[model samples]
Target: MLKDKMKEVMQYNSILNQPNAQGRYKNYKCFHCKQMGHIAKFYPMDYKKEVSDMKKDTKVQGFKASKSTELITYPKIIHFSTTCMIKDTDLTNWDKIWYISDQINRHVCYKLDNFYNIKEGFSVTKLKNQKKFLFTYELGEVLIEESGKSIMILGMYYAPEVTLNILSLDLLEKQGFETKYDGNRCTLSLIFKDKEVHTFDEDRMKKMHNKYLQDYFESLSK
Candidate 1:
C-alpha cells in the first residue's frame, strides 16, 4: 500500500511538470536569481542599488571608469569655441578654430591677438611647463557665456597661437563641480545649491584637440 501511494505521488508530480502556455514547465526556475517559478527577466532585482554601488565604486577610484564607450551625463556644461593660429603671428585673424576641453589644465588660455580691446591694468606673466608644448605670456579675465550664464575665466594669452579654448578641469572642481573620466571621455558635473549642469561629450572634444596638435606638430616638422 505504501508503494502504491508513492507511485501516485510521483504521477501527480509528473502531471504538474507539464509545459504551460508559454512552453515553460509549471515549476520553472528563474535563471537570474535561481529561484523557482520565474524566468530571468521577471526576476526582481534592485537595479537602483546596483547602479548606486557602481557609481560609488567609480567615485572611490578617482572618478575614472574602465569602459571606453560609456556615456556619462552631467547636470551642466559650459560650451565655448576658440580660433587656432599658426606660427603665433596673426592672432587677430580668425580663420579656423576648434572646440576643446582640457581635463588636466588649471586655467583658460587665449591667443593675445584674439582679444582686440584689452584694458591696461592686467598683469602679464611668463607661464611655463604647459601641456601641448605651449607657453603663455599674459594673463587676463574673459567673460564667457554658457546656456545664458556668464562667468569670468582668467585666461592667459599664449605665445604660440592656439586654435582651441580650454575649459580647465582643476578650476571646475574648485568651483564645486565633479569630474569623471572614462577612457578618452571626460565629464564635468556640478550639483550644488540645488543646481545642476553638464558638459558635452569630452572625448570628442579632446580628440579634436589632439588632431589639431598632431597637425600642428607635423607642420612644424615639415
Candidate 2:
C-alpha cells in the first residue's frame, strides 16, 4: 500500500527532474512544518526516519540512500543526507561539503586514512540488504583535523564504503560537546562545553588524510 503511494508521489517529483517538483504536489502538506509538496515523514530537513534497534545490533549500521539527492527512511540516529552539504549550515552560504547527522547513536567516518588508533574487524550491514556487510571499526578518539581548532570525534566508527564524513550526535554530547536544535532551526549545532564550535573543515581534514595515506603507503615499502 505504501509502496504504491510512493510510486505515485515519485511520478510527480520526476516531472521536473528535481527533488521537489514545484506545483506538482500542491495537495500534499507536511503536518510538521505545514509545507506543501511533501509530508512530515519525507521532510529532507533532517533526512531521518524510524528503524529497528540498530544501536543494539551494531554501533554503526548501513545508512541512508545511495545517492545524495535520494531521500529515504533512516534510523533515528542517522540524519541520512542526500546532499553532501550540512542542512543547518546551508542557509549561511558556507561552501563546506562535509555532512552533519543528528544521528542519535554512534558516529561513523568513511576513510581509514583519516583515523588512527582505531581497531578493525567491525562490520556494517547495508540498509537495503541486511545480508551484505562492509568491514569497519570503532573510532575511539580521532583527530579529524590536525590544525586550526583541531576537530575531534569522541566515539565513532569507520566504514570504507561510506562517502561523506559523519559525526555521532550521541557521543559528541557525551564527550563534552553540546548542540542546539531549535525544533526546526538546528543552528549552531556544535559547541564545546560553553563556547561555540564550528563543524570540521574539509580541506584541512583532507590534508591530514593524505598525510596519513602517504605515511601508510611508505611504510608498506619498508
Candidate 3:
C-alpha cells in the first residue's frame, strides 16, 4: 500500500517543472525598472549593477508564458513567479473551489505540493554532516548531524550560487584541498579519512549543491 501511494505521488512533476497554469497569474515585472518578462534582478543598471551583475546568470529552460511575459519592457529569457494574488474571477474560482475546500477532501494539486526534492544537486548519503538524502521532485529536505547536533531541513529554501562556491572554497582551503573554477566548472581535490580524494567537478552541479551548503552555512554565521 505504501509503495503504491508513493508511486501515485511520483507521477506529477514539481511546481518548478510543471507548466504555469494560465489562470489569473501574470508574468513577472521588475518593480525597480518597471520592466516586464523579468523580476528585479533581470534589470541590472538601477540596483547597483555590481550587485546584480555579480549574480551568476542561471537560466531555467523551457518555461511556459504568463501575464508578465507579455509585457514589452521585461527581458524575454528571464523568468519570474507571481507572489501576490490577483483578483481574477478564474483565479478566485481556483482558490475557492480547488485549493481551499476540495484540496482538503480530495487529492489536491498545486505546483509546490505535487513533487518533493530535498536539495538541488544529486542526493548523497553519509557525506560530511549529511546523514541521508530524501527527494521528491517538488519538495526536498536534508538531514545533518555533527558534534551531536542533528537537523532536518524541509523546503526549497537554499543558497545562492556565488555564496555556495565561496563557502566550498573556504572549506577546501582549510583541509588543504586544491580546487579550480574555470568560469563555469569547478574542480576539487581533497584527502578524506586517509584516502586520496580526486574529483573532476561539474560547475553547474557544484553550484547547485553549493547553493544549499552555502545557505546552510550562512544561517549558522547569522
Candidate 2 differs from the real structure by a C-alpha RMSD in angstroms, to one decimal, of 19.7
In candidate 3, what are the lDDT values of residues 57-154, reduced to their tens digit? 43222233234334334222211121122122133234221111111111112232212233334321222333323221232433322123332323
Q: What is residue 104's positional error in candidate 2, in angstroms? A: 6.0
In lDDT terms, how accurate is model 1? 0.45
Question: Looking at candidate 2, what is the lDDT of residue 33?
Answer: 46
| C-alpha lDDT of all candidate models, in order | 0.45, 0.51, 0.33
Rank the models by TM-score, top first: 2, 1, 3
True-vs-predicted CA distance for residue 110, candidate 1, Å? 3.2
Give the higher-TM-score candidate: 1 or 3.
1
- State candidate 3's TM-score: 0.15
* RMSD, every candidate, angstroms: 21.8, 19.7, 26.6
Alpha-carbon lDDT of model 2 = 0.51
Q: Candidate 2 — worst ten consecutive residues by lDDT sum?
A: 46-55
TM of each candidate vs. truth: 0.29, 0.36, 0.15
Task: Determine the C-alpha RMSD for candidate 3 after optimal superposition of all C-alphas.
Answer: 26.6
